[model samples]
Target: MPVAVITGGGAGMGLAVATVLVADGWRVALLDVNSTVGEAAAASLNSNQIKDGSEAQSLFIRTDVTKYDDLRTAFATVADRWGGNIDFVFANAGIAGGTDFYNDSDSEPQQPSLLVEEICLRGVVFTSHLAMHYMRRNKPAPGGVIVSTASAASIYASPELPLYAAAKHGVLGLMRSMSLQLASEGIRVNSILPGAIRTTLHTKTIWDQFPVGDFTPVEEVVSTVLGLVNDPTATGRAMEISAGETFDRKQPDYCNETMQRIMQGKSY
Candidate 1:
């Protein structure tokens, strides 16, 4: 059976992706730091517990993506359980907390601290590295995919959450570079840049602060993720999901022109 591994699988978009994949007949291995939530998520998807029992087989492992050893162990466990073939890996673990640009007097440490870099950027890079290691070892199967959950912040910078924006931009670069590097290996690396998803992580106050009025539903994000998983032709691409809509990453003007010139073997 094809196997998929999802980091940050305990809650939010990660859990939603796991649930959708389980329904689609893919065995899932969930990795997250929150043991309680992770275990509960696994139980929710396990085929054995359901009456119809058609759900995909699932397991949970406590992991901290910031730690390489933890990610290594989690991948090993998944490999052992699923016979060494990882069909898909979703590096979706992330965190969001920072200082408010509008409020300089808001001396709360929760606002724009170093934690954003530690968890969001550094953690994502570590997670992607581990995923790449495992993906490189996997025997090529149809639809072999590696995806990371980035944010719309990658394209449109947000001054209020500068660190978060930088981290997500780094994620986009990671995906693009990995896509080029792994193409010959039959492993496709991509990213899903979600606009605004309603999850425990995003408070109502935050949404109100955003230029966009509300958070997009989790279901909409999950559907876009599933679509990427199902589409073999989508490689080195970033798919954006937001309130009932989905779009591809827009190429920069310079890059597009450069690509056109390169294709025609002529200077722009």
Candidate 2:
């Protein structure tokens, strides 16, 4: 069976993905900052796996993504339990920046703080770096893939949430770069930009703004994630999921002949 690691896998789309993968014979390790919910979520998934007669066992490790030591320990725990090979990684943990700078009062305008950058951007970078280490040493072949949960803010600027937007944009940039750099080693990197899902991050006020039927289902996001993982030809791709719509976001390929030539010249 293939082994997979998922950050923020205790609830929402991450947990949904874990359930699906577990049913399909994937051993999953869920890493979340919330130990209570994380352990319960893993137990629930394991129950389902047992009921379905799957031999796979799911593990839940308490992890704070902002801490590199926590992330390293989580990865090590997964490796020890499931062996060295990690077929897939979902770097999906994130916190919503609740301040809307554009609509704020004159007292103070909210801005992207260090914590926002640390978890949303830096945390993802750390996870990806560690994933590459284990993926290169994967069993069978070196075919490993990483999928990140960027937001719709990644593609379009979120005036109300500039900090969140900027952090998500950083994730997109990181995903694209890793895709290119790891392609030669059979490791694919991709990101998903989801719009307004009714997760815990969405407050009641925010939920009221959208129509009753407009919330994108978590299952849709999970399905897209599975597709990206199984699609061999997919790499450096950004999938956008919103209410009643799903499509790929096209990005420019900057590595033209001119840039290649310039890089070659610099190689001397």
Candidate 3:
């Protein structure tokens, strides 16, 4: 049986991805700090298994991705349980750094600006490093994959969430570098840049601050993720998932032109 490890699999987009993967015949290991919700979500996926008529092997481990030791232990447990190989890894654990814009003087000092950096940027980096360590040791079962949940903020700068944008940009940089490094191992690493997804993480308080109702369904994002996992040729790619639209992350022509002009010392 193929095994998949999903961080932040307790709720929202993480849970959605776990459910879909389990239904498609993969055993799931859910890693998250929220023990209560994580266990519940794992149990829910086990209960929903069909066709196989047997429950999916699901384990919920309490993990803090910001800590390297915690992530090391979590991966060890999964490797031991599944015989030292993982078919896929979803570094989907992330938090939204609320509406702490630079212009907001009334906002508290301990807002999304610093918090997003710790959780999204540092956390993803630590988790992906551990994932790569384990992945390099295992033999690929036809198709080995690593997918992460980046955001549209990676490309577009959002002044309202400067830190969040910066952190996601870091995720892109991580993916780009890892893709080249991991190619020889046949372990594909990619990211899903979801524009907006209707998940619990987007709470009313958060929505009130940003006030954007447009959201792509969780199913759509999950489908895109699955496609990347199934495609052996896809590596170092980012799939953008938005409502009624999708695209691969590609460099724009203007950026290339601007770079050439800069190299030629041309004025704007």
How many clashes (backbone N, Cα, C below 3 Å) per candidate? 4, 0, 0
Flag regions of model 1 displaced more than 4 Å: 47-55, 100-112, 140-143, 204-213, 255-268
- Report every candidate's CA lDDT: 0.80, 0.88, 0.82
Q: Between prediction 1 and prediction 2, which has the larger TM-score? A: 2
Q: Which residue pairs clash within candidate 1?
A: 98-111, 98-112, 99-111, 99-112
Q: Which of candidates 1 and 2 reaches a greater lDDT?
A: 2
Best candidate, lDDT: 2
* Number of the predicted model whose TM-score against the real structure is largest: 2
Question: On residues 93-190, what C-alpha lDDT tens digit does candidate 2 reach at each position?
Answer: 98885754456466766653567667788889999999999999887778798999898999897877778888999999999878988999999999
Candidate 1 Cα RMSD after full superposition onto the native fold (Å): 4.3
Clashes of 2: 0
lDDT (Cα) of model 1: 0.80
- What would the per-residue lDDT of candidate 3 be over residues 1-268, giving only the tens digit for each residue? 8889999889988888888888878888999989999989988887776557777778899998888888899999999988988888998888874654554465565543466777788878887887787877876433368888889999998877778888899998788668877888888999999987767666776656543547787888888988889898989998888885889986445558778687446788
CA lDDT, candidate 2, residue 170: 97
* Candidate 1 minimal-lDDT segment of 10 residues: 47-56
Q: Can you tell me which runs of candidate 3 are displaced by over 4 Å?
A: 99-113, 140-143, 208-213, 252-268
